[model samples]
Target: MGTWGTSIKDNDAFADVYSEFFDFYNKGGQPEIISKKIIEDNWEILEIEEEKNSLWFALALAQWETKSLDPKIISKVEEIILSGVDLKIWLSLGASEQDIKKRKIALDKFLEKIKSDRPKAKPRKRKKLKTPIFATGDCLVFKLSNGNYGGAVVLATDNNPETAYNLVVTTRLNQSNKPTIKDFQNTEVLICNFGQWQDKADVTWYMPDLFYKDYADIYEKIGKISVDLEYDNKNHDGKGYLFKPSWTACWGMNNAADKQFESELTKPKPKKTLTIKQLTKKEKWWKVF
Candidate 1:
């Protein structure tokens, strides 16, 4: 309720949402329940039209101020982040998914930017986007520690009590150094926020050429590599924005249209047609078709 206090002036709807948020913040609101209410019930009443996900940021800031960065709150905030780009300015200023203290500092800068850059009237265009969070089934463009870029697909996610969430990913290990769209197979990886087992994960791989022959050897050489990557604007260039190694990067959920393309990419490609020589090798080749 710091800067939000100023904006609530003459806006009863904003005040109502603010009031309800603090009530839940202090009285222990069910994260999932309250989140559903915000999306379904209070969406219009919140009076945050220009920035759709601003209320989540408001609540996130409130939680930060109140020293309540629990998994419940974090998970709910993450849902809002996945839905849209309302928090672009904040994330672009380096607001992170790690420590509350660091995020508080980043949020301070974000609020200041909002105050200073508050337009007297609405602008024609929206702000530019920052790095996006990769959701399940979405294609990933990753830059390795060796300065090489690789393509991957987020297979699925699971809730782990120890780690915030686990990501099962299919990767093209030993693929081209340059980033390109290719069928990923032969390797699977799991990503998590943090834990004893998860913390030891070496995201970077030992090239499976000469040095590494088996999974054990590759696992042995697993170095602590940064997982947060910038949104690859469909460019496949190796350029990507970097985040603090400690902060868990946020991701944007793919919309239906985006999901369609991803599904196509994940589907098995048709096999090549048999050559004339191979066809002639079999006496009953014509029946094979």
Candidate 2:
């Protein structure tokens, strides 16, 4: 005799419910009806033999009852699994014993493949900063030797610092007509005019009447001008203020000048006003009290 025959067991309501559910499903009845019947009968048998196949049947029934029920079940199952549980225990409660075994095997294979095929994430590379371009002959107004604002004229071409320095030296000698470099150094002439090198010449230079217009035109032909200030402060010990000519400032000044000039050109005239009077007739009646 088998052990099953020797042992005594109580047949519960779940047995009847399961049979009814299976019968309804086999008969192609609505799954929702079957699920409700099973729930009403209090069938708690989540794990049984052939659980996976049984679950498929149950889920199919659930869908027949309500299309979204099966998907809801799947979501719940995933959430429960991710929440943490012993794999063995989780498997035990599945539709059946065989399903539990198969799922465990599949899970192990998936984990092993993930471990073998995964690539290590590499660190991201930092981007390099771009050097800015500056133009030549830009006038830079700065404090000079005698507490007076002096403009440094840019004389170098657009090139590296060393090349610009050489150009400045050559241009200075040519301008002074001095053959000796020492004679050129004694004059308050600054080399490369670093202070003014980056500053852009005011657009007023293009206008007809500016005093420096001719000099500005000559400077433009020389090279790209820029202020000599350190462009990139990455190596600087601390932050420092740098002066640069702003187009906004220049535009504002130009607007102000334009307004002043317009005011002088056209004075405000007094507004003339005219007045007129009209007469109308009316009748009044008095009542005696």
Candidate 3:
């Protein structure tokens, strides 16, 4: 139900699988090895029918694109396509006749595309990103607009320098007054909420090198405060928004979009939304949902 459309690439399960495969491949992992690793990593999902189909579909596509398609994987994908279980699931889920027709065509097209040989995309030498710019729990302030101070706290840092990034969240720093270190602990995480999650947005990033060169004299390290990011999650129908703990940079957010975020977040506004309450209500940083 995470799917939004009939396209093979339209679901979160497919996006997660395909992207992870390429992440490993681009980092110099072998296709066969990466494929096996994905299979092993998602063993639990493999037990479910729809998820099982998504796995095969995604892995077959990735392997085909890399010119390392496995015979067994292709066979599994072919069976899933011909079995029409995906469309059946769609029908069971109340998909209209028109939607079911589109899904059927999508499945056929995917099968044909993977059967054809694709030019191999060569893996490049990757420079794993730099070490996290700030340590976990480091609260910092930056002067973005004239005379305005914006606050952010490092929520977490990764161990691998290649993928290590300082995951930070912006705080509700009012436009006119500078907040005391203790005030930051009371401030809410600034977020763009528009009823549904599809309308949610955020600006985040590791400390880019330009931080010193471009934002020099504006960045200040404040006293540390503990924080865990609360993300907006959408329902299957994309109708409702749910606040969940988000601990990684991979959440859908624009890198270095802080300047734009500051425009609205730095404005003086009373807290009335759900994220602050959710944070205080039995929320654990590591909880996935």
Residue-pair clashes per prediction, in order, are 3, 15, 0
Per residue, candidate 1 scores C-alpha lDDT tens digits across 1-289 of 1011112111123333444554454455654455556557755634544333455555454444444434555565555444434344334423234323443444455444333423242222232222212243445554432344444443323222222232323233433454333233223232222211121111221111111121122111112222233232222232331111111111211111122222235443222222211211234658878
lDDT of 3 at 260: 38
| Model 1 stretches astray by more than 4 angstroms | 1-105, 120-140, 144-146, 154-176, 179-183, 193-289
Which parts of model 3 have CA positions greater than 4 angstroms off? 1-3, 125-289
The sequence of per-residue lDDT tens digits that candidate 2 reaches over residues 128-238 is: 232212233333332221232323333223243311111121111122121232322232332121111222221111111111321222222222233343222222222
Candidate 3 lDDT over 1-289, as tens digits, reads: 2323466765445656776787888778899999999999988768865556777888998898888999999988888789987888766645558768988999999999999878775455465565656776676776533466667666556556555555555665645566567766676666653212232323243433223433345457778755454322222222332433332223222212232343335443333443333432345658966
TM-score of candidate 2 to 2 decimals? 0.21
Query: Pairs clashing in candidate 1?
Result: 133-250, 133-251, 133-252
Q: Using Cα atoms with residue i matched to residue i, what is each candidate's TM-score against the true structure?
A: 0.26, 0.21, 0.50
Off by over 4 Å in 2: 1-20, 46-69, 84-102, 106-289
Q: Judged by TM-score, which candidate is best?
A: 3
Best by lDDT: 3
- Candidate structures ordered by TM-score, highest first: 3, 1, 2
Candidate 1 vs. true structure, TM-score = 0.26
